[model samples]
Target chain A: MNTIQIRNITKAYNGVTALDHVSFSFEFGKIYGFLGRNGAGKSTLINIIANRIFADSGEILIDDLPATENMAIHEKIFCMSEADLYDTGLKIKDHFKWIHRFYENFDLEKALKISEQFHLNTNLKFKALSKGYQSIFKLTVALSLHVPYIIFDEPVLGLDANHRELFYSLLLKEYENEERTFIIATHLIEEVANIIEEVILIDKGKLLLQGNVAALLETGYCVSGMAKDVEDYCSDKNVIDSDELGGLKIAYILGEKSAIPQGSNLQVSAMNLQKLFVKLTEKGGI
Target chain B: MNTIQIRNITKAYNGVTALDHVSFSFEFGKIYGFLGRNGAGKSTLINIIANRIFADSGEILIDDLPATENMAIHEKIFCMSEADLYDTGLKIKDHFKWIHRFYENFDLEKALKISEQFHLNTNLKFKALSKGYQSIFKLTVALSLHVPYIIFDEPVLGLDANHRELFYSLLLKEYENEERTFIIATHLIEEVANIIEEVILIDKGKLLLQGNVAALLETGYCVSGMAKDVEDYCSDKNVIDSDELGGLKIAYILGEKSAIPQGSNLQVSAMNLQKLFVKLTEKGGI
Candidate 1:
């Protein structure tokens, strides 16, 4: 099987640990959501995998080969980080040409087509483009590259509503047409909640949860009713989080839901991905 | 009445029109979502109101007083934009002290309390903060200010899921405790779908739609059924968009729902805000 295995990785900066013994394997041919709170080691780990930075301990294997200092392994992965690494003085079209020279399998035709759809002016320099269009330009190059795994770090930053919609639709189209894998790290969980097949969450440099998105969501149920009734019913149950609206209350519980007594006012429904993420990573809720 | 009124506002840059006679009034004590596509003039209009940029024509009034270069007008509004305007070498704590000096109503006590909640180290200089923490600091300052009107331009740019959740909860808490107006411009429509009471949509530098969110949603409905049957039924109907998957088809329609013939096998559901937005602004769809 094709997979990128991260084996017991750890990284620190100035005595502050950024990643702590994180271990996980991202399988090929699947769309995964990499999630975590701020400074949660998501970026550090992605940097390590992309070979932009090195970890203090452990190893990363790209399809069973050492990823560090291996030029061939770098060809298998493409990371589109939030930082713009392109030369600012070069024109947009020229940058595309440069990327074409670097990646043997780059699709220059598709990149130009995407730029047209985004209404990006190809003649302008990289520094001349607006912030949103700068992101669009980088995304265009990333999507058109021919790689086994493409990791997007906050792909939709500075984008507007219409462009964001267009990006998602285009991404879905690409997924349906190609066999490549996509690993997206973004804060807009609700938008990608339906697109991602798998979910991985980290907190404070530790893996908090990893599973199929649908199956994980199925295990979360919100029980809502009168405040006193919800409070009493959740007294002995595994309630992850809750909310209050005057006399009404809703408690989020985990695991298989049990039946309520007949003629009860309580109601149960599945918890959404965003709500579950908040509860799972919340300081006191967990 | 407390309000910010934009009358016949128009702006252009390098012979390209940004805002074309845009007119709108933002009333006090309500949360509003300002949305548009890239280069659609959302930022241009906002900058005009905040006095960051000039409009070729038209005027803005803050509580019936002219806002153009009026020093007192700045006191009524606080805008948190995407650009980093703070001195890079100054510490976060010193920046807060500087802001206190600039704004007579600056709430230093509240800012300190919020920093503690966000786990921000005030001793770190502005240049030393991560992109996400920089955003956190900006949001911390914006939310704690005592201005009557606050505008956040992409407030949660690089924030994580947990920090975003905390920010929204804190915003709602502040809203509940005070009488103020918030105008937020963000691309994550679904995240703010239920939070904002009103919606304002702009496209190609012109106002497209504006109304209460609930009333607008009531006019959008989606119908789905077998591909052939859906096509035959919606052939002449006012369908905004349609999607097909295998033998199944779904069509999005606007306006009030109509009675369906018996045994049609068509399923109807409410079209959500994000889907409606995509269909409405999608090129060639409207």
Candidate 2:
């Protein structure tokens, strides 16, 4: 079922339209990748959905009901933005206590377990912890909230490789047990591509594409070979982008392997989500 | 000729060893990747090389001359750290003026062109700009400096995709023209893998590996297939990491293709720099 839906949503700041008639629906029991270039309305859409900000026009619904300042609907949703939302002077334990009271499904056991694993200091004030530790604190809350609809906007931004891996594994485990809806907005596409079942592409405040992860990978190919040979074979095809090194070239094309011509001496392989995203958002001369 | 050399360098902070008996040398005209996790002594090493900090023990030489707070060797090196060196209250143009006066090779024309392309406001104060813009300003100075040795530590922390591409292209153009040495310390390995000629991996305050990029890629492989097949094939090999999805599994192994046994039904391919780094640094089993 569609857990969240928006129709003709529009948001503007001064003279600029941050989101223009953007419309999409989120299905339950699936992890979705909300992807776009920086400032492509991902955060704006999340804010509107979470009811933190009102859209200039159009409607939004959660569970087939209007999401207009409805505390019941808001209680079911949790939005974890990139910015820290902790009170600077408050102790970490106090912040946790407040969160536990705010969310009905807050799991204290899970929070405590994560804190132990991360080696968090509950006695320290929020401002005293390092940036990485602050991120861990925020993540602890988000993970423990256990809301039906959880949104994470670059949750692992400052985390090291070890912490990032741990975050992904923990999220996967939680999803397997809870079957909750998750929407992750991040620039680290390749890392989460395997975890996300659904992919949503947004560009210039418009919905570009949405589908299963495997389907998107089947549509694009990365061809590597001599620059001249690659360019020649990529003619008449949608060559999204190319990276050159000396005489060799790797071109990311939006087409199946059959579209590539024979005798090009090129190596055609599946295009990684990150590489495809970079190619699609490239500046010029595709 | 080696442009920068470090012999048994050791540093400590409050009796805690940050860099332990580190020794390395950088050549004249190659792009090097100084890779490590956060707090892996990358900043300390760079500061010592730039003469901003003194090593507790051992010696550093730049251009065959000791780097002992000597203005001569310091003038030939440029280090761009996260800390802002410009006066925060001054306008962008004024900061450029200061940089032009301090660095003999600073190119005002090139800087102006890049600033225009990046849409940076010359009249805006450094403190008034956004984090991303501040990073771009620093990048502009580093690019224009044209020093014999330029070191960038997490240069694109807040930059988006478009700006990162522009920065990489600009760095390449400068390298082609001047043949100077560039050392980049960052965690975003895959993004810069194509441009980096050499890779230096540091783990737990010690050097793990350092060599050409192509050689590293040739050694690390990612194999994917049935879970049982993958597990069996990876049992005897050095499996750096693994990811499971339903009945399928993928494992990143460090070895040559010919080492694998037949009848595994596995598809092997080269591993990405980021994936390899994660695998090598992971503490436990995948």
Candidate 3:
């Protein structure tokens, strides 16, 4: 199979488990949204997949081949994390040249082209670039690499709205040009809602849900009306969360949405991706 | 006047200007969104208001009293910035006690209550907390202080969806309990659109626009249909930005939305805050 498969991967840091037998797979070509709450071990899983760290148990396979510490499959995947790995003293263009020499599949022409599109100055040193530009630099490298799988961890961390929109459009263009797997782990769910084809949710180092974005959004909805009316309508529904404002009430439900009764005062609305993630991952109190 | 009046504030670092004759007033008892692109001098202006940095020219007034280095007006305002000002060695509870002595209106009781509501372990040291928890601690201090003015610089930087939602509700509750000025500088425009009453936008160290949020959103809208239809409809309109995908087109326009023709296929929709900000500030090309 042309996929990156994980079989019971478990990792721990000083006896605290970060991944508890987390098993999942990324098919050959699809854009995925990897979502989770803080301290949910997203970075841990990404690092393990990139071979930056070792998992205590289980294995990662790429096209049925072992992925752990195997240089043969190194050119197949690229992970752009938040941590700065490039030399601070090196100029942007110089770093691109260095990466071209290191990775067999690195495309220097594409790197310069993307840099031009983002208006990134190639003459500036890594340390001189602002936080937003630094993110642009990292994403430029990820976009330039001809890898089958690329993971972007917080790609737009410090970007403004214009730059973020530019990045998304560029990503879509790249996806259209080639069939490759792109996994983005970010907190800005609403912005990526329309871009990602599928979603993989993790909570407490365990896989909670994974499916098509449209299918998942279809299951979650909101029913709002007068306080008493909302309560009566949601009495038999699967209410995940709710809010009350004086006489107005809204109940967030997770299940097949039913038709409103005749002369009912209730109104139905689709639950957005961010709301679904929050309601499913939130534990206990506020 | 119960407001923070910035009178022709001008500041520069080295030879480059950060804020050039920028003037604006944040009135009392309302939430305002301070929005701008990266390197647009938001932090520079915020630091001047907080008295952490001085402006080369002009003055800041709180209720008609000079705010720069004025000890009398210090207690009237509190700025919770991204930079950490607390002692990293001290426990959360200990830090709260220390803050109690620094500010005359510090409410220790409210601080403890807010911490408990966030499920923050007050016994843990500042350095021991994660990035999300650190943001929560900073916000807790800001909420506990009974000041007439408060500024939050990227308050939700490392926070997850649940925490961000919790912070927004807490902020609204705080505003409801006491009518005070709250200035939030964030890149997440859509999330804060409904919460803010007014908006202050700056670009390239200059004030671009400032007005009521509802009025601003009402002025910006989008017309979408066939490429030719959108072009024809927007030819006389104030089109700010546009996108073309195959045969479809989306033209973002700023002005009164006129009624479409009886046989026209163009559809008009309200423009979102993020799109408005992007179209207004984006220059040159993608």
User: Which candidate gets the maximum TM-score versus the true structure?
Assistant: 1
How many residue pairs collide in each prediction? Answer: 0, 0, 0
Residue-level lDDT for B183 in candidate 3: 93
> Each model's fnat?
0.89, 0.30, 0.65
lDDT (tens digit, per residue) of candidate 1 on A114-224: 999999899999999987898899889878987888898888888877787778788888888988889988887877887899998988898888989989889878899
Scanning candidate 2 chain A in windows of ten residues, the lowest lDDT window is A277-286
lDDT of 2 by residue, A166-209 (tens): 88888888998987998998777888988999988777787877
- Give the better candidate number (2 or 3) by lDDT: 3
Which digits, one per residue and each the tens of the lDDT, describe model 3 over residues B1-286?
A: 9999999999999989999999989999999999999889998898898898999999999999888756889789999986787889999999998999999899999999988988889999999997678989999999889999999988887678888999999999999999899999999899999799999999999999999998899988989889998998887898888877679998888889888878998877678888889877875221
Off by over 4 Å in 2: A64-70, A116-124, A128-130, A226-232, A259-266, A282-286, B68-70, B226-232, B259-265, B283-286
TM-score of each: 0.91, 0.88, 0.89
In order, what are the TM-scores of chain A for the candidates?
A: 0.89, 0.89, 0.91
lDDT score for residue A14 of model 2: 79
Pairs that collide in candidate 2 are: none
Q: lDDT, candidate 3, residue A244?
A: 74
Residue B85 C-alpha lDDT in model 3? 78
Task: For candidate 1, write residues B79-115 as lDDT tens digits.
Answer: 8887788899999999999999999878999999999
The TM-score measured for candidate 1 stands at 0.91
Reference contacts reproduced by model 2: 0.30
The residue pairs in collision within model 3 are none
